[model samples]
Target: MHGEPADEGQYTVVAKNPVDKVQASAKVSVCTKSKVDKLADVAVNIGENARIQCQYSGIPISTIIWYKDGKLIPTNDQRFVITQETPTLSVLTINNTDMDDKGVYSVKLTNTTGDVEGKVNLTVKPIKPAITRDLDTSYTGTKGEDLILSIAGTDNPYPTCQWVKNNTELTPTTDPRIQFKENKKTNEYFLIIKNATQNHMEEYQAQLINVSGLIKSKKNKITIQKQPTFIKKLQTIRVNQTDTGKMECQIDALPQTRVYF
Candidate 1:
């Protein structure tokens, strides 16, 4: 192209490289590599979310894939779902996971240039359940006494409570031996034992189950001991020095309960 230059106008010529200039080789050949991409100290909890990320240093960002303990993690449990606007390749999600879900995860960036791998450890923390009770321990009640069992605890969503007796689970049966009551106002649970019996006097526990797992309260036992009755008996007894009748005392219990001074 040619251009006319005015007296005050400045003009210059520019040169372009040959069409095959890009095809020229420096000495012989060269190749690029996929950049390293990895996350660090990743931590999460059960019923929580976690995201692993890696950025590419190469001219072009590499295609990355997340792996859990050397196993390729799918977008949908093995499906490849690409997310837009992010440099991430794959994401692994564990719903209501356990201690077993923890492991080392690697980010593998594979592309036409080469392959790069970066590692990170996934830490899934254990969830500790919170517990609440109406009372710590109770005194032995009379026969046919109604005992309430109420338990509350904290968890991700909520905590589940169950009454365990001698390591055996008990369900509401038609035998009418036990009754279950839930206090909505207090958000507590109760196990009512109607007409307490010696058989009901055994080791019992309130177990709490949450997303993490099952946890038991301190071992508790129900003692069915009854109180002794006091009686004032009138007896004419002769005193050696006074030579007069003095009052006497006697206490008795139907079940032969023990008397403590």
Candidate 2:
């Protein structure tokens, strides 16, 4: 049928068309997938190629159109093409989907006599990687604090994770006090700091990088908890004795540490 309504419907003046008044006030008969009003849930990752299909069941078959952001997105954009063979409508192919593609998509069904609409939301997210860490890294001899460094997010594209300290890369192979470990299967990465030093007290970063050279998460700074230390010196007025507040503390650690108790 042409874009215009033209002479499509069975309607006319003064009983000119037999079916005009019979079905004028009634909606088109929907028997199949047309009973429902919307598409199924769709989840896609950024930079991935995805397809969204809308469906409706009816005996008379329905004509469908798709819209993005409320406007008709012609089947031209490389990221968006249309396929009609499938009941409701088909999103041909969305190439290189990105953050911008995340939104609500609508499918409009139009028949000579009536029309109906439905919508679906598209969500794009980076893969979350497995993560592990040495929770505590506090001590009197070295840097006084608990530390952990690693990006906990991962994906199928094999995310590149790096620890940043004061905007600098934190490499485990070279740094003696730092240990960086990653388990790809679990998508877990860990940063272990042994006998931390004052230098480890600086800003810590965990960045998740992908093949597309896109950084999903920026320098996620890891929090560090440093224990408080107190020193006291006391002198007795007995004119003969000098005393120092003998304050001694012992620390014991588990899994990722040592004990001084």
In candidate 1, the residue pairs with backbone N, CA or C atoms under 3 Å apart (3 or more residues apart, or in different chains) clash, namely 74-78, 144-195, 149-189, 149-190, 149-191, 150-189
Model 2: per-residue Cα lDDT over 52-84, one tens digit each: 777675445677777778988765576687777
lDDT of all predictions: 0.62, 0.59
Tell me how far the alpha carbon of residue 13 in candidate 2 is from the true structure, in angstroms, after superposition: 23
The candidate that wins on lDDT is: 1
Residue 44 miss distance in model 1 (angstroms): 2.4
Off by over 4 Å in 1: 1-31, 77-84, 87-100, 132-148, 155-195, 198-261
Stretches of candidate 2 off by over 4 Å are: 1-38, 87-89, 128-261
Model 1, span 1-261: residue lDDT tens: 232222223334454586533332222122347766545667887556665555555534567676788987755552223443465334544555556668887777776667888888878776766675533654455644665555766554345678877788767773368776665555566677877766777666777676678767665677665555557766766678857655766665435665443
Please give the distance, in angstroms, between residue 211's alpha carbon in candidate 2 and its true position after superposition.
16
Q: Against the hidden reference, what TM-scores do the models get? A: 0.48, 0.39
